[model samples]
Target chain A: MTNKLLYLSQADVKSVGLTMAEIIEATEKGFMEMGNNRVEMPPKPGIHPGEGGDNFIHAMPAFIPAMDAAGVKWVSGYPGNQQKGLPYINGLLILNDPETGLPLSVMDCSWITAMRTAAASAVSAKYLARPESSTIGILACGVQGHTNLEAMNVLFPLKKVMAYDPSPENAEKLARFGKETLGLEVTIVSDPKDAVTGCDIVVTSGPILKVPHATIQAGWLNEGTFVSCVDFDSFFSREALKEAAKWTTDNLDQYNHYKDKVGFFVDCPGVYAELGELVTGKKKGRENATEKNFAANLGLAMEDMAVAPLIYKKAAEKNIGTWLTL
Target chain B: MTNKLLYLSQADVKSVGLTMAEIIEATEKGFMEMGNNRVEMPPKPGIHPGEGGDNFIHAMPAFIPAMDAAGVKWVSGYPGNQQKGLPYINGLLILNDPETGLPLSVMDCSWITAMRTAAASAVSAKYLARPESSTIGILACGVQGHTNLEAMNVLFPLKKVMAYDPSPENAEKLARFGKETLGLEVTIVSDPKDAVTGCDIVVTSGPILKVPHATIQAGWLNEGTFVSCVDFDSFFSREALKEAAKWTTDNLDQYNHYKDKVGFFVDCPGVYAELGELVTGKKKGRENATEKNFAANLGLAMEDMAVAPLIYKKAAEKNIGTWLTL
Candidate 1:
């Protein structure tokens, strides 16, 4: 008769420190489960029945079918959030009983975003990125950029990391941050190509309302390299994506929705073969680590979907916040 | 920057002891605002294209375009809920500022539900039930049954109350309980006709798994008597509802969803009106004291919509729960 309501605060969540490494790892695990077809990844575009609002509020919920736990997360994006000092991406993740209706926990979703998006990139790298890849190129120094590197390092043994960001402070901040925190060799490059050259993994987390090119110089792309992105605009050419040996997304319906909103990124490697499909083995991962591939890391609901259960468990174990009794 | 999560026990809500009279008055205000088209009731059924369940989760949100707050109450009906002990209807009424996304409160929906459903019913009786209605016939003497009497008594001058239940002891217990607590005439009738005869109103708050019908001898329905139902059964003939001078519901879309689920129990009255629509001169209420009318109280999102605000205001004023630094 009791409702299991667990509350976790930013401080509580921080004290527990859902680490950058942890998010990357969980995301990889998420993809592993998804690829095995044990994770539920429903479509991501939501109700647009209302008028005049540019952002879409999507409902992403995932239950690792084998794990017996599920979480439903609501992610709302309105580009206008910046003018108001709110993070452009904002959401809540509620972990609940998969069997009963009790709400087990509620957590801030900023971290959920980092892990899922990066996990998606990691899945692409595991399957499509070159095995001998020694360097990685990054396009931004924000949160997604931070996690993307962690995911790459875990899934691939990269020797060098380089980035291009207009903000000196961001570049400097992440320069020291990545080295000290992630233990990666880092450098700040002056131009996109300065960072793009000779790299086997090209990762782009963009400030893309303003962007470089969607299509990179084909000559610049080393054979058997991989390109991963959170923004399709960062790599504008569908042709660039088409050239890769393989294409993938966290979920295909989501990729299609994104295509509808932002236009073609590439003929997506058929949407069903998305990360979850790959996990489920409906499709195979990299024929070899040397396969050239492109994965659009559009952040699957399955990421928050899978992570929701983790947050609920941790918060409950700690008796984190005030319980709501009804 | 802060989330005020509050919990109230069912006992605490009962302690609020807001009578059907007070709630009736509050709903009058709610109706005035709703009638002005201030209440935003949007189409709730959105099927997730790739979702695997037979049930759909709907979101019903409203902004009293002129009020201090807004909320999107997510009412997810998976139907799998019934196999578990959970109540079929479950959701959170999130209260937030209209100008800012600051959440003022989060409260249990059960209280909001019990009160608002009763309030809407009371408002219906105020406008549609017979004047000097001395007695009422109650079918399905459960939660809905108990509250309908509480609300009806507040809006009418009832001299007696009678009920028929499949479980005779349950009927006897409820009757004894009502007589002791409600303090007026109450009885457990042996026959459905006995419960209905000589009563000015017949109330049906049914949650029957299948359709239920009550065959009425002509005299069992006194002249100028009214029928109110929370059920979608073939309890009364189509001729009965067709002959009603007025036919109404709290929200039209909700009734339509119900209509789709349970085919018409009555003929479509040539006159169809919303309770709030009538308040705004979009339609009219009862025109004659003797008019036999039917009010189908399917309930609305806007009713529980006020709970978070009400709880926020009350909890803030009374310093009811502990606060957390998140």
Candidate 2:
């Protein structure tokens, strides 16, 4: 009968001390649920603001019955915010009690979004990437670059990281984190092709754009490399996508939804399978070591649902957040 | 660059003291914006929980550029909650700074939803109903019934109310409010037809159902009667809906979206115009005195966006809410 719900700030969410491995495991479980047809997720409904119509606020809602998680994540991504010294993405996540449909917790979505997105890519790479993959090429060395590096390091025996960013300062910052915090050899590549040609796994984490200014060329990627595109075709050219032996996505319905409306995937290679299908063994993953693999993992609300409840429980146990009454 | 947002509970929202007249005016402005193509409102995306799939949580987001309003209302409706001594609908509205896309306030959505929904109905009737409207009939004697009565009282003169509910206690409650608060002649009608037969304005506030158990039949409505359906075709039969000379809705796209997916309004009359068109004078309302006009106002997020910012400003000026840092 209590109407109090826990509220966690961005700092409080980080204080919960969730590991990259834990987030990857949770995100994989969500995809497994999806593969088994146990979750409900509608393609995100969004509104574009500003004159250029590039900034967006999306309402993503999902329900995973097996996880007992049901809620909505109201998040915004304003590429213009970076010029104002604000984060590019910010929002909140509301987790509801499955039985009564009452909000149980409200938490900052930035931290969860940052970690879960990289975790999804990590989950995809685990099934698609070569087992002996030791080098990673990361584009756009922002929050996603750092988190994706951390996540990939958890699954692969990464020996060195090649980072590329339009801003040398951002690339240097990520390089420092990779060398000091993760204890890996890091290289800052001036050309985007230098970052992609020799690496065994490549991750493109640039902003999703309505009109892509893609730089990665068709023949740039090494043979047997696995490519994870967190950004929606903004970093990879159409020819580059077609060069892959098999291209998969996190969710086929969501990819098709955005492709039709936003005009992202135009005349590109057809998706071979959803990541969930690969996770549940419903489809094959990296059948041969020499076959190039690619996955465009547009984030899903179910991934947030998968990770948020765990954070809420941990924060409650540690007494780390404020409880506000409704 | 402040990351703090005002949080108002339900009591704090009530303390702001927004009148029905103000709410009606604001809702009218929202409709005008819709008609003028100045607002961005996507069809609501929802998730149905529970085994029976009757419980729902919907994310309604809108941006009204002229009003400088942008936000999302996360609301849930569980009919089973009534038996558990909980309100059937509970939610929170988060208003964001349109310039920076940072949240400015978070407030309870129940009060705003109730008031704005009725205000929309009243606005519809203002254009569609006879100018000398006196008697009003309300179908469900719940929160919407009382609010609808209050809204109708603001726009009409010297009225009587015919209240109908399956439960006599609820009807009695609404009857008491009509007589004591509004000082109107009130009657509790046992038959649904009695509530609709002689009224100038009829309001149906029943629960929105996937499979509607319609009771009101064709020929039940009187000539020159204006019908407002807050619920989705749950009270009025298809024949009753077809009986209207002119049929309109709050938003045509939303109505069609739901109609295709939820199987409501199957084989019903085609809509003549949106309520926004009527508000903006693009379409006629009631051209003749003998015409029966009907409008189904499936509540819009733009309506909430219209009312919520006003409450936030008032509550801030009064220092009536908690400021929580993000």
Candidate 3:
């Protein structure tokens, strides 16, 4: 049998220039599919190698029947890579044809991870955030912080953003990127409280660590604000989580697994509904216009499966990648 | 960062011309590492899509600390592929640099699976089988059957093979392969009973089904015959498994997982030792020449990880595959 696979590098995928709107739409659909019970995503299997078991490589596999997408993403997070001047996170995604079980494309997943993660939070915001939300507060000015801002613009008419980073240089870099790339008014705040106070939407995209400290306090959030903690509650205070009218996660299985690993979800208020259930209308998203909602999105393989196939289709249509026979 | 990955096709891997003995040694070494608790192999995560869930795609990721090798094998088995003139089993293996978490090579896993699986059986025979074996009995004349014979010849001085298949044409094909490739005298038997009776080594390598039924029975073997059931318990009778003096599996977790799914391991005799323990000398292999030993190998990711890097090194030295920068 002759099977030729398309190889899309990070550069090639960048050249394809997938729009944030497209990714958000697809990611929302993926969450809807999950809520509707049309997807099969097992809890990722992980292997921790190297010293101290600090470095981890996880295998995330999923099948979305509605999208006819099946694939696995092999991703790694090495905290020590910073010392060696290498990327802290890198991965590869293999997309397979659901019918034939043949790999259609192998693409660098750094872009996919960044885009899908941001899109998940954006989708949660679309359902949970208040209408006519304008200002946004972002914690940790990194890839997730920047992409989260870009994704929020798809569904909200945001005019300004209050950004904060522990590193002042990174905060300035994110501010410049926001002004140049997204053309939004950006303010670099010195304190986490200044960054989060009185914002319509709040996003904590900081690095995940073992120790949990209250960063965003309960008193900082404004009324009717939507909070999305993409970093597994590392930045959100337990008091802040308890103060929310409704709290949810992307998937229950993954949330519990990580909760066991790091004590985050166990101490927080009970999850009222998963984001998928709200997206699919299986459960209520916001009970009232004044209700405060908090969503913890750990990300999902279904999101990657949904978005990778679209990128593959776009790359193939544009003839943007190297093709090799197997 | 110039992360270029090597790609080895099925043809490229076949051209590597890996010797059966080398693979057996590496696979045995891998088992020893597993027995020594030097490898991290999470249970495989699988996705079963479509109706009836007859087809399955599994992600097997493993890290061997001793080998300093890490990888994941994405494999699929579709029973319906035969109707569409496609191979039932197709897969790919991606080898990553354990230290840097960057992919080094992506190779076709069909060859690796066949060779490593056969090598595992050969390793079991080296420890479990009688040293003075002269004849072998093989159930099912497929890839496993032919490769098992080739691998067994590396450790045993077998004079002839008794082969069986439900179809006469396949029986003849296996007989020809045994004669032409292995230079062994082969007899195609009409019944499973005739094929397995009074042989020094018996291997039940047939297609696994949902229902468990008896195929190879207790009375159809010699007193000290080494029995290896590579296809779960589909071919071996419970009575035969009970008759053995000692029974073992490659991995206890996987065996129990399948036991929950198919009700095989629960009814069998208690496991004396895993193959790794035997290879590591942590446990005994055979107590005496008259003792009967049974092995059930459920195919581990460590086997693929152990063999794929050797093939990658060979391909790199020979400059035998396409390289793409990621």
Taking chain B only, the TM-score of every model is 0.84, 0.96, 0.97
- RMSD to the hidden true structure, all candidates: 4.6, 2.3, 1.7
Which run of 10 residues does model 2 chain B get worst, by summed lDDT? B261-270
Interface RMSD of each: 5.5, 0.9, 0.9
Candidate 1 at residue A273, lDDT?
56
lDDT per residue (tens digit) for residues B172-287 in model 3: 88898889988899998888887777789988888875565688777777788898888877887778777788788899888877888756665788778888999999888887
Interface Cα RMSD for candidate 2? 0.9
DockQ for candidate 3: 0.76
Let me know the TM-score candidate 1 reaches against the reference structure: 0.83
User: Candidate 3 docking: what grade?
Assistant: medium
True contacts kept of each: 0.09, 0.56, 0.66
Candidates by TM-score, descending order: 3, 2, 1
lDDT of 2 by residue, B18-98 (tens): 899999999999999999999998878878889888889999999999999999999999889989988899888888888
Q: Tell me how far the alpha carbon of residue A271 in candidate 1 is from the true structure, in angstroms, after superposition.
A: 5.0
- Taking the tens digit of each residue's C-alpha lDDT, what string does model 3 give over A1-326? 23888899889988898999999999989988999988999889978889988888899999998988899999988888888887888888988878877788889999999999999999999889987888999999899998998898778998899999989888988899889988889999988898788789988888885566678777888889998888777887777777889888899887887788656665877788998899989888877777888888888889999999889989989999988876
